[model samples]
Target: MPSQPDSSQLNNGSSAHRTLSGGGEMGALMRTIDWAKTPVGPVEKWPHSLKTAVRILLDCRLPMYIAWGKEFTQFYNDAYRSIVGNKHPAAMGISAQETWPEIWSTIGPMWVEVWQGQSFGFDNFKLTIERFGYPEDCYFDFSYSPVPDDTGNVAGVLVTFTETTEKVLLQQRLQASADQLTRIFEHAPVGIALLSGPELVYEFVNEPYLELVDHRPVIGKPLRVALPELAGQGIYESLAQAYETGQPYIGRPQMLLKRGQPPTLQHCAFEVVYQPLPDQQGQTESIVVIGFEVTELVKAQREAELANRAKDEFLAMLGHELRNPLAPILTALNLMQLRGTSEVERERTIIERQVRHLVALVDDLLDVSRLARGKLTLKKQRIELAEIIAEAVEQCSPLLEQRHHQLELQVPNTGLTVEADPRRLTQVIANLLNNAAKYTEPGGKVTILGERLDDEVLLWVRDNGSGIEPELLPKIFDLFYQEQQSMERSQGGLGLGLAIVKNLVGLHGGRVTAASAGKGRGSEFSVWLPFALATQAEETLEVIPNLSQPGQLRILIVDDNMDGAEMLATSLSLYGHTIQVAHDGLEGLKAAQSFLPDVAILDIGLPTINGYELARRIRQLPELQKIRLLAVSGYGQQEDRERSLEAGFDLHLVKPVDFVDLNTALFEEQP
Candidate 1:
């Protein structure tokens, strides 16, 4: 005899308890009992099955509701109340659709499926339900299965659901992260990919990654599918070892072949990082690989290295070739002048001029090298600016004649002395004058002026020749940059003269500037050099005293080449010296003993005994030791001169030497 169940529990209805457990456990087990046959509901107060189901529902997190067709919507537990809030009456007595109109769309669809005896599932579903008098967006993972009656007909839909808002948001975050990673991988310039197992299957690839290996499809395929040649080249083995040990492998400067009609080799730098992918089980499954293509850079670097080496060798050979022939040429010209014959004298002048031109060219090339290294050293002294100008004018006189130009000079009576390197100063003025003569029209005038300023000396060279174009004037001092007109003709030089002048003048603590109104007008180059105050201006000397005597001196000449030795001896004898010739160093030593000459001019490059050894042995003898030792050879670099001096020679002369200069060096005054 059970009393009626409490009015509060009844009013709350079974839906209240049913909602709490999310329709699982005891609620499901109790559903196995037939409620109609059992002593349940108000008549029995409360049955064991109903109590058990209610308790189980109270503990559930899922929200469940029981709706009697056209009756109230009853929520049994906390889960259902959380969903509906304070919307309905406190018990099962209201229509569900009338209470929550906004959520009817989802409910209507679910009701249709369950009533038709079908079980349906929806994932990542959304529902807009009225909670607390406010409509809110909700995400749910809900499923409904029809509950059948004794006749096997569907009676009600059993719904199971859970709030999925957090999971859905988490999924969105994961997707965003994946998208960002994909962007970085896709746009990367280097090749990037994933590799798995011994097959090295690719799981992902970017644009540059695929294009690197001939643009073959790599995703979902083994690395060998596109790079079968790599196995033969041993790249596959390297990659496998790196993966097995979880170590990274890097290959630098490897040559790879391109995929094309005509394949070309490409140099690439590669890095394979074995990053193991983890599954739900937490295990490494894949590796990532990255690579860089460096073919262009490597090729360019090698080409540049080869070019530099070739240029150095060329310069070394050129220096040797030019210096070698100078000694004999100078000696021959000097002897020719001694003959005092009109024909010989005229020929000697021509040879001398050509020699001077060749010397200037060699000097310029060497200066270029010095300038590049920032090693063009200047030895400055108190020098007469006007005299320097005169020397430069003399050097460029031939060029002026060739241009048929008229030259004029203007010098101040005083304050024309500058603290500068005499040789470099003359070179600067000469180069400017030569350039003017070259560009000026025939019959044009080139005027050189020297003036004294308070702190500096001003030397300006002005030419009424072809003037520089406006655009070219600014860059006139740039190395190897000749004007357009100059390059179009054979008369154009290497364009190093102005550059050398600028550098040399700068080294002397001076400045040089060029200016011209425009083309075909004329040009002016002005130089300002530091000045040294002078008590008196030095007058120009008329003549330098000759040192060599008219009387004869016995001399021995030695050379490997017979023609060269004979030609040299013939020239020396004509200069009032008795000469004996030998074809080799050994023969020359023998000749020295027999001839006993006042002076012995030796060639460094001779057969058998070398120049240094020959000179040493000769100096060992008392009679030969007393005689003057002159080294006349083509090797005339600073090092060569030092070595010759060490070898006991009184003077070391470079080949193709200037006979007049050498004569002045050897004989300060004629005997």
Candidate 2:
């Protein structure tokens, strides 16, 4: 049997509790059992509400600590028990810092607040610990409330919490999603922005939108500070309408502003979608406005429309201006040729030249269209500067002789070479010289000079002629612009000569300039061209020559037009080749076999069998295969030459061919 415990130690234990019991209806009930002498034990005998409350607090999903003097206790519900593992019971009955030292720094202050009877709570609190010997960082929402004694003083703290790891992480994830979407909106191309509030403050602006005026992060700024150009444009009023009605407003492409010297005008198109931001109660708090800009595509479309209109007008005027003078001049030349040795022959030659000038003018107008559409291409080769200059001088010889001008030529004997399209370069130089001769008085001096300078070759045509006026010199290269009031205009050109010269030179990666000591003193036009370096220079010159020996060998001439074939065949027979003329390629092939001609002249456009196909068939005949095949056609582009070579022709010549060049080609040796 056990001895009785001391009564004085029991009386001291529950003195305060007995005092409260005396004032209540349970005071008489406590006296019979000596309430002051009750022993301290586990809280299993607490009232239902107290037990349920403590149970609820202990059952929380967060790790908790409660301390009463020296007796410290820790509890982890199902959620937090996993964190401590085998250390659960040992983790209990210890100070929070001793059990989870890593989290004690933050937990210490929260415990003080709870013990002092102040309620405390925190959301998304980070808890890092190694309680069970593994490190972890977790999120939690925690709260502490005091558990008061019957005397109304706090005796213990009720730590209540939820392991808000998922909730805290989920909330942070939502914020991160919002931030990412905001970044995309703020940097999108073509001026994206948001407008908010009644004052139209800019809530956000993207990188591109800010670059429209060179700023950074246009957040928290008034719209007017950046774009005062919007005044009276009704933008703000429209935004007010959108904000008030919760409906979107759209803006079509319109003029925005102008800036820069030579001041460029800006145009923009935009549409805004207005949205109402709401609270949890669904009440509107603010408005969101979105904007988008489109300008370049609209400008391109408008320019294309204008160019189409200009081309149509240019073609119509060109036809009327060119064809009107050709009829009488052709008729007079025909009559003069019939009376071979007459004074009328001289007059007819003048008429013929004037008619050719008109034809050239029409050709230039069409060429402008071709150049604009990227259709103009060149036939380039390494050529002698002297040869090119001589050709140009010869072409302008009649004009020089007509004006009685003393034309001089100066070029290096060793040959300064230029990479160029030969025929085009000849035309360019001839136009300059002819214009000088036309404007100069009789007996005026004209000189053509070529000199190598550094890596380039420069050619100059200078004349003691009536020069360009100072006012018109700037526009001399412009199409159809002439200095009509000056002596330079007496030449009566449509002003296309210099314009074509400039374009042709540019195509060869060269440049040209026209200069004069004011009007009438003199004028000089200089062309600068890149010359081939010695390493890449051509070694041999190509010459096309007529037969040097007298030729009575049989020749076959094929053309689609009867007159064209007969006339060419007759000319060849006079030059002493046994000639056979055929209007179609099929007949020409038959004549070629019968005559077994030494040479064949074929037109590319022929009925029944095309010249290319007939040439292929002729090559198949062993007897006629060795005979030369020359393609003659009005199609003279670079592509035409390539096609002719592919179709087995030895040479390709454009129509209305130069008789001298043809003669040279017919007789020239292959080597």
Which of the numbered candidates is closest to the native, going by highest TM-score?
Answer: 1
C-alpha lDDT values of all predictions: 0.69, 0.66
lDDT of 2 by residue, 351-371 (tens): 778766766666666566556
The number of clashing residue pairs in each candidate reads 17, 7
Whole-model lDDT, candidate 2?
0.66
- Candidate 2 lDDT at 464 equals 91
Which pairs clash in model 2?
186-206, 545-664, 545-665, 546-663, 546-664, 546-667, 547-667
Model 1 clash tally, residue pairs = 17
The count of backbone overlaps in candidate 2 is: 7
- The 10-residue segment of model 2 with minimum total lDDT is 22-31
Candidate 1 structure quality by residue, lDDT tens digits, 366-446: 677666656566666676787788788888888898778888889864567787777878999999999888888788999
